[model samples]
Structures are given as structure tokens and as C-alpha cells.
Target chain A: MLKELDPLLHSQLRLGVMSLLMSLESADFTFLKEKTNSTAGNLSVQIDKLSEAGYIEVIKSFRDKKPLTTCKITKKGIKAFEQYVEVLKQYIK
Target chain B: MNDEKNLTPQESLEVITSMIRQAKGNMKKSSFYFLLWGWTIVLANLCVFILIKFTTITNPFLVFGLTIPAAIISVVYGIRQGKQITAPTMLDNINRWQWTGFGFTCFIFAFFGQRIGWQINPVIITMCAAPTFLTGIMLRFKPLILGGIVFWVMGILSFLAPVSWQFLLASFAVTFGYLVPGYMLKKTEA
Candidate 1:
């Protein structure tokens, strides 16, 4: 039997965020926007969805008096990403 | 990039690979500390060699006092750089701890070496090898690994050399151990 794909991570931008977070300790809003090549408004919506799903934690703070948003994957997110990849391999192979 | 579109499995994998590559590429490092320490060590070794050979300086160890300024500069530089980055990678944390450990070990060796009547220079050269080697492994930079091995070899040679000449071996060790690899790290991204 094939595994079901993670609906939370199946979309392109969310998966891109997850993949980037997987490799890094954490990344800021600007960094994620740059890497995802997404506009602020759209990226914010996707980030909120992922946060609501408990796949990522968003930390808002200030750097040099400028507001900063940093995102990191949760343990639940990692498990979901791994399972997503495993299921993806089944489809691609 | 399409933010809301569904991705095919192949496109999904591609996005994963590309994003990971981009993150890795964004890893920032400054060669300032490496070059600073490398030049300082080389100069300290040379200063000792010069004082012992040409001058009638009674205590050549006074040259090592130069490290006081180097340490101050290091601390200031570290603080400034720490403030600059919003996020530090896991590798960055590991590197920081490893070097901090090395710094403590060196202090311990220096403090105890005199009491134990141990030759400090040769022992210091031996101690230098561990951090350089482990750093190489962490960064996947081969020159640093070789440089670490060079420190060990130089350490052994320093043991065989006469007391005054151990300074010369130490000079060679830092030349290869820190400066060469330091420059290479500055040049290479990975």
C-alpha cells in the first residue's frame, strides 16, 4: 500500500520552506522570501497555514530595532517531511 | 516560484535539492579570526626565535605577551560578529564550542606546563593539532586536515630539536598549521 502525501507539505512554497528549514538552524522572513522567490503577502499566508498545522514555529523578534521573523521546523514537521519524501519516492520511482 | 501551486513528485524533489543547495551556499564565514591568529602565532614564534638568537633578552617568553592584544581583538571581533547574524547554523555552534574548548585546553597546558617542567612549545604544537583537524573534518576542507597532521609532525620534531631551536619548529608548524590553511579557507567557499 502507498503512503498518503502530507497535505500540509504537498504545496510548493510550504515544501520549499520545509526543505530549507531542514538544512538550517533557522531562517528569517527575508531569507525565506528570497529562497522561495515568493511575495510577502502570499508567503505570509502559507507560513501561517504551516504554523497552524504545527509543522513550524514562527518566532518574531527585533534585530537592530527592525522586526524579524524567523522560522524553524518542529519535530512533527521533520517527521512529516520525511514521510512525504518516502511517499514521493514511491510515486517517482 | 509558485507559492500555491501543486507540485509533481519530480518538481517537488527538484525544489528540495535546489533549496538545500541555496541554504548551504548562503553559509557565511569571515577569515578574520583565522588570519589574525595565524599571523599573531607566526609573529610570536618569530619574536621568540629572534630574541633568543640575536638579542640578550633574559626572558624570551615576554614576546608571547603579544597574545594579550590578540585575545582582546578576538573577543571584540567575536562580539561584533555575533551581533551581525540573526541565525547561526549548527555547524557554527559546533565550531564555536570546539575552538572554545581548544582555548581552555591551551590555558591549562600553559599554566601546568611550567610547574611540570614540561617544554611548553612542543606540547602546544601537539595540542594545536586536534582543533585544526576536527575543524577540517567539519568543514570538509582537506588542507586544514593536512595542516593538523603537520602540527603533530612539527611537534615531534620540536621535541628532538634543542631548546632554542624548538621555536623554529614552532614557526614552521604555524606557517603550515594555520596560515596556509587560513588563506585557503578564505579563498574557498566550501
Candidate 2:
């Protein structure tokens, strides 16, 4: 029997954000917005959801006197993403 | 990027794969550093060679003072480029540390140059090989890997040659090791 997918990673924008973070050490807010093709409002909401779930770490700092927000996948998020992929493979099989 | 829309397993996998690919960034901008350092080193090497061979210069090694400005330019440009970067890849971090290690080692060598008889040229050439080779491996770019090998060979030859000849060999090494591969890297991106 296949396990249930993590609900937090089931949404399109959240999953995209997670996937992108997995490949990088960290990424800033603008990068996520451009890559995911999501509006800042939508990306911000999804990022907050991921941060609240402990699936990602959000780092807010200043760059050149401007506010900068960076995000990186958490350890728990990696496990969840891996498990999601495993279940996904099973469904395809 | 709809927040409310749920993705099927297949679509989820697709999104993951695509995003990962997108995050695997191109190192095209990095070519600038290689080219900058390459020309700087080359010019210094030739200048030293000329001064030693013909001119009555008390300290031909002073030609290396050129590196001070090159180092400054590199730091300023690097900081500006770093600010613009949104996605910072693991490879970028590794590359930065690798070169930083190289810089520290060179500094240590320079500090002890008088004590060590200033025979650090051959060893410096050898040191250049490591980062160049590893960077090529990381980028999977064969030209740079070959360039690294060329540096190794020139480094060994420098050890065997006379002190005056060492500068000439170093110039050749930088040409193959940094300049050639750097230009190729830029062209590949274009």
C-alpha cells in the first residue's frame, strides 16, 4: 500500500518552491517569484505556509538597505519531498 | 502557480523535476573572473620576464603589484554580482570557498617568500591547477579540465627550468589554464 502524500507539499506553488530550494543552498524571494511564475502575493502566502509547517526556513535580512527574504528547505522538508517522490513513483508504476 | 489547485502525482513530479533543472544555474558570469585574473597574471609574468632579461630593475617582482588592483576589482565586482544573485547554488558556494582557500595559501606563501628563497613560482603554478581542475569538474566543462592539466605540466616544467625561465613558463600556464578556458566558457554561454 502506498502512503499518503504530504498535504503541505501538494499545492503547485508550494511544491515548486520546495523543489527549487532542494537544488539550491538558498534562494531569495524574487527568485522564487520569477521561477515559479507566481505573483508576489501568492508566493508570499505559500512561503509562509511552508515556513509555518517547518518545511522551510525563512531568513529575512537587509541587502543594500533594502529588505531581503531568503528561503531554504529544512531537513524535514527533504524527507517529505523524497517520500512524496517515492509514492509518486509507485502510483506511476 | 495556483495555491488552491492540487496537483496529481505526475504533475507534482513534473514540477519537481522542472524546478530542480531551473535551479541548476549557468556559470557564464563566472567566466569574467577567470578572464580577469588570467590577463592580469599574464601581464605581470611578461613584465617581470622583460625587466629581469634586459632592464636594470632592482625588484622585478614589484611588477606583481599589479595584482593589488586586480584583487580590488575582483572583490568589488564579486560583491556587486553577489548582490544581484537571487538563487545561490551549492556549486557557487563551493567555488567561492575553493578560490578563497587559494588566495589564503598564496598570501601565506608571499609572507614567507624571503624565508623560502622566493622559489614559490613553480608551486604557485601547481596551486593554480587544483581550483581550475575542480571547477571544470563541477561545471562538466572539458576545456577547463584540459587547461588544468596544462597548468600542471607547465608547473612541473617551471620547477626544472632556470629562475628567469620560470616567469615565461608561468605566462604560458596562465594562457592555457585560465585565458583559453575562460574565453571558451564565455563563448559556450553565448
Candidate 3:
């Protein structure tokens, strides 16, 4: 049977962000922005969506007297990502 | 980067692979520690050899005081680099803890140095091998792995040689085990 693709992870920018965070322990907002090549507004919105879904944890703090935001994938996010990849493999097959 | 655009399975796979590659992060900066400690140890060993062999100095071990400044430099550099690191990997944590363990072991040996007598050089060289070799394995750099083996061999040879020649052997151990591989790692990064 074919599995349903994760709508939340199907979009380009969010998927890119998730992919980046999957391998890293945690990543700065600037790193995500640079890697995804997304505008700040769009990246913030997507990050907020992921945070709301509890797929990623958003940490906001101060670094060197400036605002610093870092993001890490949650356990739920890892499970989801793994399932998504498994489903992807089926599609490829 | 289009937020609304859906990706095909193949495209998704590509994104995952590419991002993982990007997250691999260059470990080349680690070569700094290898090179720093390598040169420091080499110089300290040479100084001890020269002072004991030629100079009238009663306490040749004073040369080890150089490590105090090296430790300070390592700490300051480490903290500054830590602040700059946006993404720390699991391997980074492993490498850090491995060296921290090694540092503690060295202190233990120093505290017992008088009890151990002249055999301390061989024991220290043997101690240096574990972290150096394991780090090389973790970094997947062949030269470092080989360097670790060299340390082990030298440590054993130092035990066999006369006590007076042990410092020279120790110097050779760091030269091959740390400095040579460190330079190779730096060049590879460059």
C-alpha cells in the first residue's frame, strides 16, 4: 500500500530546513537562512510553523549582546523525518 | 527556497543528501591543537635534553613550565572558537571529551612522577598514543592513525633504551605522531 506523504514536510523551504537540522546538533537562524537561501520573512514563518507543530525546538537567546536564535530537531521530528524517508523510498521503488 | 512549492521524492532525497554533506563541517580547524601541542611537546623535550646534557641547571624540568602558557592559550582559543561555532557535531563532543580524559590522566601521572622515576617518559608516551590514535580514527585521517602507532612504538622503544635517551625518543614520538600528521591535516584542509 502507498503511504501518504507528510504535507508539513512536502514544502521546499521547510523540508530544506528540516534536512539541515537533521544532521546538526543545533543550528543558528542565520545558518538556516544562509543554507536554505530563503528570505528572512519566509524562513521565520516556516520555522514558526515547525515550532508550532513541535517538530523543531526554537531557542532564542543573546549572543555577544545581539539576539541569537537556534533551532534543533525534536524527537517527534526525527520520527517523522524517518517515516518520511521510508515513504520516499517506497515512492522511489 | 519557495515555501509553497512541493518537492518530488527524488528532489527531497537530493535535498537530504546535500544538506547532510553541508553539515559534515570542516574539522580542519582541529589541526590547530595538534600542531600547537605537537610543537610545544617537541620543544619541551628538546629543552630537557639539552639542559640535562649540557647546562649546569639543577632542575631541568623547569622547561615544563612552558605548558602553563600553552594551556592558557588553548583555553582562550577554545572559548573564542566555541562562541563562533554555530553547529557542533557529535564527533566534536566525542573528541573534546577524549582529550579532556587524556588531560586528567596526564595530571595523575605528573602527581605520581616521583614514584614512577625515569620510566615516566615511556609511560607518558604510551599515554599519548591512545588519544592521538583514537582521534585520528575519528577524524578518518590515515596520517594521524599512523602517527598514533608511531607513538606507541616509540613508547616501547623508550622503555628499552637507556633512561638518558628517553627524552630524545619522546621528542621523536611527538615529531612523527603529532607534528607530521598535524601538518598533513592542515595541508589537506588548505
The candidate maximizing lDDT is 2
**CA lDDT, every prediction?**
0.85, 0.89, 0.86
Model 2, residue A11: C-alpha shift (Å): 1.5
lDDT, candidate 2, residue A33? Answer: 95
Candidate 1 per-residue lDDT, tens place, B13-56, comes to: 99999988887745556567778988888899898899989999
Clashing pairs in 3: none
Looking at candidate 3, what TM-score does chain B attain? Answer: 0.89
Best by TM-score: 2
Model 3 chain B: which ten-residue window has the lowest total lDDT? B21-30
Q: Which stretches of candidate 1 lie over 4 Å from their true place?
A: B188-190
Ordered by lDDT, highest first, the candidates read: 2, 3, 1
Q: What is the lDDT of residue A67 in candidate 3?
A: 99
- Residue pairs that clash (backbone atoms under 3 angstroms), model 1: none
Give TM-scores for every candidate, taking all chains together and pairing residue i with residue i: 0.89, 0.93, 0.91
What is the lDDT for B141 in model 2? 91
Tens digit per residue, CA lDDT, model 2, A53-72 = 99999999999899999999
Docking class of 2: high
True contacts kept of 2: 0.95
